[model samples]
Target: MRAPLLCALLLLAGLQACVQAFYLPGVAPQDFKRKDVIYLKVNKLSSIKNQLPYEYYSLPYCRPEKIVQSAENLGEVLRGDRIENSLYQIQMRVDEQCKVLCRIDALSGAQTKAFKAKIEDDYRVNMILDNLPVAMVKMRKDEKSNSLVKLYERGFPVGFTATTSGGQPEVKFFLHNHLRFTILYHKDEITDLARIVGFEVEPFSVKHTYETPWDKVSPTLNTCNPGRATFVTHDMPPQPVKEGEEVIFTYDVRFVASDIRWASRWDTYLLMIDDQIHWFSIINSVMIVLFLTGMVAMIIVRTLHRDITKYNQLESGEDAQEETGWKLVHGDVFRPPANASLLATFVGTGVQLFGMAMVTMLFALLGFLSPANRGGLMTAMLMMFVFMGLFAGYFSARLYKSFRGEEWKKTTMRTALLFPGVCFGIFFCLNILIWGQKSSGAVPFGTLFALCFLWFGISVPLVFIGSYFGYKKPAPEDPVRTNKIPRQIPDQPWYMNPVFSCLVGGVLPFGAVFIELFFILTSMWLHQFYYLFGFLTLVFIILLVTCAEITIVLCYFQLCSEDYHWWWRAYFTSGSSALYLFAYSAFYFYSKLDITKTVPMLMYFGYMSMISIGFFCLTGTMGFYACYIFVRQIYGAVKID
Candidate 1:
């Protein structure tokens, strides 16, 4: 017994050490000594205008002897991150001046053309050191305050066009080949241990003229001080990428001690945005929308109460039956809607997505999901969506049964396949487009298979189990019996027409959220970090309230008009907001972005379509549930014999 106990204790210690060694999905900080070699990893060449990312090697540039790729997670791959080793070198706590990286001889015509096109398209080079993205130090003046505004441009330009001093019409293109790095490290006074707290770089286009012979390893440059070899800042003429041109690449490194702590290192980088996000405007706009919705909702509830009272008091009297507006259609109101199966499928999927969003946002708001953990948000969303299948299946089954629908198998299949199928179809097409361009943004076939496995293996099974239990439960009886024959709905006024009413109903919900949508879109296409989960959660709640109230009000109007076909209209009334969302996206594309290519244009619209569809589902579900509850309460309150 003593011998076994010793062996078990030894095994447990080994396991604990192994777990600490691999603390998973997140990385810990490293302590650097005086001469530690720090590797530079090249990320994608990005542009806010084009809204598409290309691999670092897409443009012809200096290459290391043997390029090696770093392993990445699912979210990183989806986000188009391709971190790989580069030719540039660095040493921690050791300053170097004008160190030669590489010398590229005879730039090809294709390479030159590519460089020029990228410059015209406003591409920027992005490099990573110690997980910190390089940024350019730029200065701007505030228009309103009339003060100098300091800014850190996230990435430096790949190249720029410069006009000739002779005032010629032709402009020359210059490539940024030289970089100056300023690394900030925080050292513990007691132990003298240092941790990298910040990384910044200033890129310049310099044509170097060397007095010494060209050497692959060491080339003494006339541009450098040579004495100190640590304070080189040559303001030489820029080099243009041309056919058969000798382009030299060099970089300088300097280290500075900082007061920042390792834990709070990301605070400065995360809050590096130049312009304020304008939260006050967004909140005020949403409040106006809410105020309008509240008034309409109050009117609806009071009018409904008065109508119900009149109907209930005169059940024995013949004259007062026609007096109550909605009571006349009580018989036909409970009728199962057309395409009830489809409606159930859509609502079920919407419930899943809503659950996913709520959980993810709450986690983010609680600070459990930090931006420092790359890919954490995407991974969380995907995982939540998958697991939320249980709610979708249960709700779909219950709803279909409420509609008195048979063919359970058909409904189940539709619930499982419909929404996810459409989303995957769009995503796969976008991936194909990315693959055609030979970009790293494309999801690999293996990753696609893994996605399939998650869908089929995990989510599908959970959904099936929930559906089985849901179908077994008895469907709740309707408040009023559905008539055998439907009532002839009166001709509605022009304002109450289906299309006009849906369009009007959607406007309020769109008004409530469009302000927040702008920032979300900016974060998506412009590659800006958006972690204001508290505000996002609040906006979503407001959107839900808006959708529900507008839907209930419009549904009440339909019942008052003696038109009982409220099922599809209630869904579409809230869903029409998605049309406005897509339209807003189009306006944003034209007004805010400068994407000139057809492929990127298609990509922008395609992704926006997916976003719109998800929004439609979310808002529509809210409306449907609100209408369902309202109809039940109003009808159940009166004696409908």
Candidate 2:
């Protein structure tokens, strides 16, 4: 007894350690040392340069190697009449009109004063000051500044570069004057350069011009900086451009950089600890766990009770006349789900895929596969697919046995391949598009093969195992006999149709999220920052509830109308989330974005469309299974002829 107790305590300790290690970051002590923080300086644009096409504008890709070659000769790259880089460290890509837009960054306290002084002194700079945060600027001596400035400003993202080659010791800050046409001097060498250029300088703390949401870990961002042209608007302005025709407007900005003090990774951790918890992960986990527990508990308890009660009655030889829930539908229990052949295949695959999804999500939430894990999610999802395939095989075989469906091989093959195949095909096409763009963020070829391997290796064998057991179970007997002649489905009016009801059921949930959808799309497509996982999870739960309730309510109404063909309709009714998701994404583009045309927009929504479909299937499956159980219970318990 003593030994056993000791062993149990040891095991518990190990588990606790594991949990703590995963949940917490930066518990160990580390030396505090500052690192290099890169800054950008965008030049100002002249009036004539503001209205130029993207094709006519050009920005040189600056690197240390190039910097050495063009040292002290920065004007070689700043030759264009336009303001190329309004935001720091970002390079702009051209649009159809050869113009670039700008994003604003928060200036350090010291930089703020200098910028204000420049604004007061220069009237020409004030004319193109749309992107500047008027609210922040208004709080100072410039009381006459407009308080309402739109967040988005039109300008170019001029190119700038800085490096800490020998680490912090060799570090220097880059600063630019209002015109950005001439070299003002480096902050570190300011005293030396001040003597040469004759301007007194003061030192200040250097911070990012704009806060990048994921900058803590993902600092090496070259692809998503401001001033880059949008992929979709490569061919905007349908007419052929004249040599000097204007397309997109641009603006000028001036920046100077200085450094006072720095924080290390350890410093950042301490700062976060001093502040409040991140809260996003914790909140999402708690709610998800609660909902899952409730759902699972309800299914387990009700199902076990009903099964035991039926078995006892059958054995007792009581005139099975009590005809209570689910048992009343003996005849229909094995009736093919509406669109049985199609739905059976689709859902079978979905069930398998679902199992995989659950495992992957659990692992991610548990920190086995975190954002830090990189491609771990893809790897895990692929492996789960194979295991889920096995479940699909088993479920298909069991349902076929219940139906006394002949040609077992056909059923098994269709069940095993159909749903997974469709999902794969859709995902594959999108992946191809991602590849064409040479996106490093896209799924890799090796991962795709791994997915295939997992399906064949894990899922196939498991499916066979499941099928063997499914075939062994005795077939369920029908309580009611089928009529020799099939009953004809009535011709309902347009509004009564399944398609119409599905569309209606989706409206409310879609409305609830359309506004939020803009932020999400901006993050993904426009490469904007978003880390609101907690709020997203809350909305997700609401979405799930909304989808399930609305679908069920519509299903109930249809059943009242005597429409028994709910199999596929029930699924699609809730499944309309896919349509709504795509539609809202489209709305975000047209209403919320300043996109030019089809290609990038199509690419953007296309990937999102696939994700929406996958989620649609997941939500729709939940609704279908829930309604199926409810219908089977209420109707199956009734003593119908």
Candidate lDDT scores, in order, read: 0.80, 0.44
Tens-digit lDDT track of model 1 for 1-641: 65335434543543343233223232578888878899888988888766678888988888877889777766777888888899877887999888888877778889889899889888998888777778776677787899886556677899889777765578889888888899989987787778988888888888777865676666777765446453345467788877878788888898999988888877665554423454764576577556867766675567767776777674546676446478899899989999999999888888988988997787788775666656667767777777777778889899999998887668877877878889899999988988887777788899899789868876776677667667879999998898898888888899899999999989988988887788888888877777777778878887888888888889988888888999999999998999999999999998988888877888899889988998898889988888898899889998865
Candidate number achieving the greatest TM-score relative to the actual structure: 1
TM of each candidate vs. truth: 0.91, 0.50
lDDT of 2: 0.44
Q: How far does residue 402 in candidate 2 sit from its true spot (Å)? A: 3.6
RMSD of each: 5.7, 17.1
Query: Candidate 2: which stretches are off by over 4 Å?
Result: 1-334, 337-339, 364-371, 375-386, 426-447, 459-481, 490-494, 508-519, 528-540, 594-599
For model 2, how does the per-residue alpha-carbon lDDT over 137-250 read when each residue is reduced to its tens digit?
A: 111122246454212222322212234566465422222221221111123343332100111111111112223453433332222224453222212222111222222212
What candidate 1 gets wrong by more than 4 Å, as runs, is 1-26, 140-149, 165-168, 228-234, 272-278, 314-316
Angstrom error of the Cα, residue 308, model 2: value is 22
Worst 10 residues of 2 by lDDT: 194-203
Considering summed lDDT, which 10 consecutive residues are worst modelled in model 1? 17-26
Task: State the TM-score for model 2.
Answer: 0.50
